[model samples]
Target: MATWAIGDIQGCFDEFTALLRAIDFRPDRDRLWLVGDLVNRGPKSLETLRFVHSLGDGAITLLGNHDLHLLAVAAGHGRLRRGDTLDEVLGAPDREPLLDWLRGRPLFHYDPALDMAMVHAALAPGWDLATAKTRAAEVQTALTSDADGYFAHMYGDTPHRWDNALRGWRRLRVITDYLTRVRFCRPDGTYDMRAKGPPGTQPEGYLPWFALPDRASAGTPIVFGHWSSIGLVDGHDVYALDTGCVWGRQLSALCLEEGRWVSVDCSARGSGAGD
Candidate 1:
């Protein structure tokens, strides 16, 4: 059996299917690992969600920011912003099932056999693998327990840094941001959530999370997305699989077992866009 790590789908269902076909993905014999953002910002959000959900055990998906946003909006905790394209999903007949499946998904996934982990975005510099897992579970418990209350407080860019001493919603917010929205971050562990460009565009003191000198999770291969602007970067023991497929780029997939990559040009477009 083959294990393939695919980049963000972001509602680009056509390209997603094309990439799967290109890789000869057989649900019976192959397992797929998705980096998340399975819906939003591209055509066919509902279709993308349904197809992935139908894959059942053949697919393992970590929740991305968009996925959380969908849940938030569905729970009446967040609003649909300008350029948002999630109406179809919100109004779908299967919305509850889809949303339920998504909320049940974790913020992080690890395979002990592969010594590999997957998150929607970057891990904080201070979190070793064990710490990362424990912290992820904390946020997951909060998210699944009181989703309405969780989504109500899920937004924001502060406290800007992580502290184990942080409590309540503030702690969960920090963990969610780091795991879902982070890109450029300072060595001191403060996030630059506004920086969305490539590596050189980071603010003066900030660098890509993985590039930090003291990143504690550097020991494991963390496959992640949420940085479409950076496209595909595969070094420093991390795999960035988002190839901007929703922006008319390519859908990417990496064969983790063989370290092989496969991509297919995307043709979908929609009003919404971002990392």
Candidate 2:
């Protein structure tokens, strides 16, 4: 059986299907690991959600910022953004099941036997695999238990760093930021959420999280997708898969065990940058 890890779909269902076809994906025998952002910004958010959800055990998706935003909006905690294409999803007849299923997805996915892990964004510089998993579970619990309350407090850059002493929403907020929206960060695990460009454009004091010299997760193989600006990078023990498919770029995927890569060109331009 083959295991393929795909980049953000972001409602670009046509390109997503094309990429799957290019990989010759056999749902009965192959497994797909999606690096989140399965909806929004493209034309078919509703179809995208249903297609992935229909995949059942054949697929696994981690939650990205867009996925969380969908939940927040569904819970009446977030406002529709200028470029959001989530109306189809919100108005769908199956919206409840789709949103609930999305909320249940983990913020991080790791398999020790395969020596692989996946997160929508960066793993905190200070977190090892075990600690990252535990922290993810903590946030997941809060998200599942009180989705509205969680969504209400989810929007922020506060407590911009991770601290063991952090408790309540502060701790969950920081963890959510790291696992979903992080790109550049200080070595101390403090985030630079405002920097949306590629590595060279980041502030002088910060570095791409994966580039940190002392990152505890450095040696662990990770698959992440939030940095579409960085495109399809493969290095630093991580595979960067978000190829800006929703922005007229290519949809990409990596064969985990073989380290092979495949992609399909996309023509849809749904949203602008800094999503």
Best by TM-score: 2
Q: Model 1: what TM-score?
A: 0.97
Point out where model 1 deviates above 4 Å.
Answer: 268-273
Model 1: colliding residue pairs: none
Badly placed stretches (over 4 Å) of model 2 are 268-272
Residue-level lDDT of model 2, residues 18-125, one tens digit each, is: 889999999999999999999988898888899999999899899999999999998999999988999988988898998889999999889776899999999889
State each model's CA lDDT, in order: 0.90, 0.91
lDDT of 2 at 155: 96
Question: What is the TM-score of each predicted model, taking all chains together?
Answer: 0.97, 0.98
Model 1 agreement with the true structure over 16-103: per-residue lDDT tens digits? 9999999999999999999889998888899999999999999999899999999999998899987677999999998899899999
Residue pairs in steric clash, candidate 2?
none
